[model samples]
Target: MIRDDHQAGPTLTSPRSNGARISLAHGGGGQLTDELIGGLVLPRLGNGLLNELLDSAVLPLDAQHRLALTIDAYVVTPWRFAGGDIGRLAVSGTVNDLSVAGAKPLGLALSMILAEGLPQRDLDVVLASVAQASSEAGVPVVTGDTKVVGHGQADGIYLITAGVGVVPTDRRLHPDSIKAGDALIINGPIGEHGLTVMLAREMPEIDSVLRSDVAPLNHLINRVMTRHGGGVHFMRDATRSGLAGLAADLAKQSGRHITLDEAVIPVRPEARHAADMLGLDPLEVANEGKVVIVADRNQADQIVATMREHELGKQACVIGWVGDDGDGICELNTLIGGRRIIQKPYGEQLPRIC
Candidate 1:
């Protein structure tokens, strides 16, 4: 467990451009990833809107509306996993990013990088999955590009998807709106996506029932926003670095302490077992279909109840709460009645899982 005094800071000690090269950990979406972005990427490219660092960039549109845009790349090694494929992952990931920003998705743009000698059948399957996921989310793929590279130059396939949505000027969700006593909730069980993919890739012989929880969350999020927009303060999808990453980030961004109750955090039995066997912390594992929400404390129960009505959020429950202002520390109340600080993982635990 990371100690509270273990402050997060720039991990790179050398000059920005001197003898530095990118590594897989830089894309792991953890502290090192943050350092890379904050230390290098932001300094060169950040603007007012980009500096906000929200999952989606909220841009001015007309007087009554704004635009939300997000893009993500899918490089899951197998490109296909239990319950979802790369195409589904690409579309769902993009759509969820928009939804957490309180936007209604308008359309998507997809680009594919294909390796030469890749089977045409595999491409067909991926495209079909993309179409089905798009239809399910009620979002259309408006435009796209495709390119082919030498057999060894690329993975079997790589998918990049960008999504655009419209948000009412008043509905922007941000950490600035969160306050002490706000309730933190999650939509369903965690760690399924990462665990499922890992098992499928590394331990396929194991007879496990784990499945990736990769699905578009626009409808479920829209439902909550429609009924409890006023109570909702902030929302984020727990993706690359999982729930712990998001919580740690929330504490830092909100400048408030956060407390999560371990007993109530939903982790399925199979996922927990797999995590233990693999020496992994479920809290730090990736999740594709989970969103951590901060809402008014008084309406936490109501929001959970509302979430339960949706298929995607049937296991929704309160997992934590925002505490008084502090140095942005997050603590977990363990199942054994112990308390420990929660910090973002320094690097990737499971790579190529998303």
Candidate 2:
């Protein structure tokens, strides 16, 4: 069951001051976003399930089954990008949230907010994309709602999706299960999705090969869980604030150090160049088609070999490992025999690239 009534009210405050206000950075999924959720949202509404703060909330439905639910809103500008649009993003994002939590997606509920001047052709195109993505993931859009707003009120279109899935009672995936000797593995390269969207929105004139890596990862994850369920301890998709953000959060939550090897982290040359040109760190860029997994050290090699057999996991490899020392610190071993600490980005670096 879900609750909409809470006695407490929202407590908003500027990141730098005592005054109450909201900033764009608050939605960037960085430090500000964390503060907003931890300080304000949690104080007013956090409960046993919500306090867990996993990608999706897992709830027991009966003696033999458990339910996982997740909701997300997409306000990505341009509505369309090189490899995907907002519709595909909404579906994939919601589905991935459930999958990482060890759930088999059941269905989705979609809600759309449309601007008055939005074109019907654009709406039809987006809906078609949504249907196609849902079919690819083997899930259905079971219900929906639509609302029209004044011209310019909505950014052409906005999508909100809620996904429900079933988790086997035996499956266990959470940060608390992570251990110092566990290995960190990622399915593929990072920075493609965020860089693609940024270039498409800002420098449409410059031709590049970058394309948003936006696709549902449920099948790929399901295969991994089937073979290595006993070894897998935790999983999280590197979204909004990117791989660095996710790694940092994992370290803090598990109370262990995370050390990443820069040489092994897969990054395409084109993506590296684009990031350097834009003065952005590729490690902090968002990705829609990637997930970070923590698994037993003994099973790491076999897991990578199995992952490489799938299309989505073609470049899968071990990028890091949990350490026995430090208090929630994440460090990167540089290619030049140097090291640096990784921190969650303080504020918005690349805005609206989600």
Candidate 3:
């Protein structure tokens, strides 16, 4: 819990580079990761459009049209999982990135890097999943390239997918649009995707059943946008670094104090226990099939009700509210009525769990 009297300066929440060599944590999507982007990457390649740092970069096509572009790469160790495979992850990940930006996905470009000695049968399965997921999301695969690496030089397979979508003429969603007193909502439980992947790799001996919650969320997001429009100010898919990461980013971007009630957040019992056993915080894990939304306080209830009408949002609930904080902090109210600061993790709990 953050102390009520605690005051902070107007420091940017973005990451800063410290001249240290890159580590896996830099890509973990946490505090250090943000620093790498803000300090190093952005300095070298950033421009006005890139500086916004939204999941997808929104580009203006004309006065009435805007394009959203986002790209994601998949390198999950096993490639195949209980609920989905890398192919599915590639599609869902890219599609969700565009969707969360309030865009209607038009198509995707798939690129593949294959290692020598990779099995043809495995490639078939992965490509099939990709095709199916693309069709299911109604986003066609428009263009792609494939490359092969020498043996021992690459993982079995790696997938890079880029997507393009069209933002509605009337929609203007960004963290800048959020303010204090706004309500935060999450669709469905958290940690399933991270826990599922961890269990499959670290504790395969265990027999507990848990599957990754990997699905395309464009339709659900479109539904909310259609009704709420500007009322829904910000949206993010809680992927790497989980809900905590999203919360911290939002707080910093909005420059507001974001507080969450731990008791009200939904987490599957299995995920909770699994996280406990693994000595990890479910909030800091990853999620592939969940979304976090920030909407006007007056419209929060209606937004939740509308979310519930969708299968993907059946478990949606308001999790917290924004507060006046000059320092851009995120706080969590625990079960014992204690409040504490929710610091973003320095790195992800598990590597390559996405």
Candidate 1: pairs in clash = none
Q: Which ten residues in a row have the lowest lDDT in candidate 2?
A: 1-10
lDDT of each: 0.91, 0.90, 0.86
For each candidate in turn, the TM-score is: 0.96, 0.95, 0.93
Tens-place lDDT digits, model 3, residues 1-354: 222221222223343533367787777888777776766666678666666777898888877879999998888877887788899999999999999999999999999999999999999999999999998899999999999999999989999999999997778788777888899999899999888888888888878777899999998888888888778988999999999888987887777899999999999899999899888899999999999999999999988999999999999999999887756889999989999888779875778866
State the RMSD for candidate 2. Answer: 3.7
Q: Top lDDT: which candidate number?
A: 1
Models sorted by lDDT, best on top? 1, 2, 3
Best by TM-score: 1
**lDDT of candidate 1?**
0.91
Residue-by-residue lDDT tens digits, candidate 2, 119-203: 8999999999999999999999999999999987768999999999999999989887889899999999999999998888878
Off by over 4 Å in 3: 1-19
How many times do residue backbones clash in model 2?
Answer: 0
Better of 1 and 3 by TM-score: 1
Better of 2 and 3 by lDDT: 2
TM-score of 1: 0.96
